[model samples]
Target: MTQTLRFLEDGLASDQIVALLDLHLREMHAWSPPCSVHAMSVERLRAPDVTFWSAWDSEHLAGCGALKHLDAVHGEVKSMRAHPDYRGKGVGKAILVHLLEQAKARGYSRLSLETGTSDEFAAPRGLYAAHGFEECGPFSDYEPDPFSYFMTRTL
Candidate 1:
């Protein structure tokens, strides 16, 4: 399905967006230990260093994701999730592509992210790998953890 992207200044102003974000966080908690979860809260996404976006299939919300400016030459991907109704519909890929474009536009030389290492995260891991995000050591403030899988790609 065709989707349009909308920039969210404060992350989620509408109730539909809010619901989607809530689901994203709940799933993160379910799949990863609290300390290992790097999903951003709405407030964090509102920070000056972060930019969030949502994909919409017409009036319906399809997915959401964010890019965080870690420094002059680096960016971090955060809070990527497809709405249940839109799973497997390319929403996540679209968001990831958008985040990469944004990172490049800002002149970031590298883009990195932390995802889960559990069996449940295999698909996401594959997605990142397919997009040229290879396994990497943690970037920014993140520390190594068994539950965390770090990936990075030169932008």
Candidate 2:
């Protein structure tokens, strides 16, 4: 099937997005303890400093991600998730690329993210690595934690 994919700049208020965010939060909690979960809530994602994107494939919400401006020269990736039915279909990669481009367009010299360190997150870490993100110390007010894995790449 030839599916049409489009990425929208904002989807925070949509019902489809609400469900996706809920799923992301649930997955995060499932993978780590409460203190280790850094996934943002929908309200937090709607903040002015965050630019959220939702990927749609022929009217289906395939995935979503967000870029949060940490400072004039830095940004952070947040809330990246692919729909259960869309895993391994490049939806997550598409969202990540979109967020990276957005960060670059805003003149961010560095991009960073915090993800879980468990086996469930290995695939995501690999994806980040493939995109040139390397292991790094915590950034943007994040404290070092055993359950959290930090990664960053210079733009």
Candidate 3:
């Protein structure tokens, strides 16, 4: 039998969560310049407009993702990351599906995201494409950037 993936909307006050988020930040900076790295800091993810959740398999953290309200009809996917030990186990997909569901529940008409264009990001890009996201120009506060690729899907 498959173990259920538990999504927890916590207080974001735990050391483990902060450490994972910081790891995500470091990875983002490694792949792009400071100007091109759009991953949110821990403090930023605490904003009122952002809703964040972590995926867990029993007591183990599988991954995490967040959705940011851009407008009444638009939402942005943010801060997605699978724990290193959970990389090939559907953790990312689980987090993404949760975000998409949350977006739809909130009546968002569309969802968008920004990710790197490097080879390191091919897997994530593929995952998004498989889930109906299509390549698009930058959205919201973003500008044209070679290091970044944008994707959006109607909800």
Candidate 4:
């Protein structure tokens, strides 16, 4: 894949972007309720603290991810998705690495994420674990949610 990744704001309007979010929501709905709480609409993703990044194979959108600044030293991973056509093709890993690199560059000391605690979320949990995040209690404004698993990594 001849891929290029770029930072974007107001970027969720594209049909491909909408499709990716729909897939994410569909997958999450089948997860436990608490896990489902972490899902957000594209409108919510445009909040000021969030920075979104998207990966493209030329004109085709391959995947997208986002990071939200929780505080000076803390960041949260959000809205990670890989196109169905690109799953298992390293598109997610590449986007994740790029997001992590951006977090480090911004001097964040800890990176955190929330994912479903169900079979559907296994791959996402595994991906975060491979990147050095260890399971942890909820951070920031999150309350305990049975469907959710929180993980963190110190930069």
Candidate 5:
């Protein structure tokens, strides 16, 4: 499939995107403690500091990811999820690559992310690790949480 990644200023307005995000939120809530579920709501993702992107395979949305500017030289990856039907199809990796490129383009010196430390998040953790992200201490406004794993990679 030919997948294209494009910036989305109002992704939450799309039912398809909203549904995917809803699923993501549900999964996060189900797997992590309430305080550990840091997944952003669709409304929060539309904030000025967040740049959201959707990956489309022709007419279908395959995956989505976001970059949240934390500082002049730092960025945080957020809301990365692949459509249920698009799993194992490189959709998530494509979104991650796109987010990383966007961070570098914005002159970020570092990229970081927070994900669950449970089996449910093993794949995502592996994906980030493969992209050179190493386990790190909590960053930005995050605090230490046993259920959360923080990682960062230098740009």
Candidate 6:
């Protein structure tokens, strides 16, 4: 599938984006003890520190992701989701690569992220691992949470 990834300044307003967030929350809540927080609402996603991106395939929203600035040389990945129809088609990886490049271009030397520690998050964790993110202690404002696994990569 041909996909195009782009930086989004105001991308959370779209219905597809809202649907993706909703799906992420639902899947997260299904985990034992519920791993992910019910954050990333449209309002929160539009915050100044957050830079969102959406992947499109012939006008269809295939996936989406975001990066939040933690400091001058660090960033955190957030709200990565691939549409159900596009899973296993490399949409997630493409979006991830795009985000990483954007982060590096912005002068970030490190990237960190928190994801669930449940089966539902296996694919995501694997993706990050393949991208050179090693399991790490919590960074930024996050605290130690059993349901969450933290990872980081130094660019």
The top-ranked prediction according to TM-score is 3
In model 2, state the lDDT of residue 3. 41
Worst 10 residues of 6 by lDDT: 2-11
How far off is residue 21 in model 3, in Å? 0.6
lDDT of 2 at 59: 84
Residue-level lDDT of model 2, residues 1-155, one tens digit each, is 11466888885888989998998999899989999999999989989989898888888889898998899999999999998889999887888888888889999999999999999999999999999999999998899999999999999
Structure candidate 4, residue pairs in collision = none
Instruction: Name the candidate that leads on lDDT.
Output: 3
- Give per-residue lDDT, candidate 2, residue 89: 90
- Whole-model lDDT values for every prediction: 0.84, 0.90, 0.91, 0.84, 0.89, 0.83
Using all chains and alpha carbons, the TM-scores for the candidates as numbered come to 0.93, 0.96, 0.97, 0.91, 0.95, 0.91
Residues 1-155, candidate 5, lDDT per residue (tens digit)?
A: 52454445445678998899999999999999998999999999989999888777777888889999999999999999999998877778888888898999999999999999999899999999999999999999999999999999999
Q: Which segments of candidate 6 are over 4 A away from where they belong?
A: 2-9, 32-39
Clashes of each: 0, 0, 0, 0, 0, 0
Report clash pairs, candidate 3.
Answer: none
* Winner of 1 and 6 under TM-score: 1
Query: Which runs in model 4 stand beyond 4 Å of their true positions?
Result: 2-10
> Least accurate stretch of 10 residues (summed lDDT) in model 1?
2-11
* Candidate 6 lDDT, 1-155, residue by residue in tens: 63455445545888888888888777777773643463476678889989888777877888888889989999999888889999999988888898899899999999999888878789999999999999999787778888889999999
Clashing pairs in 5: none
- Residue-level lDDT tens digits of model 3 in 48-101: 989989888888877889999999999999988998989988888888888999
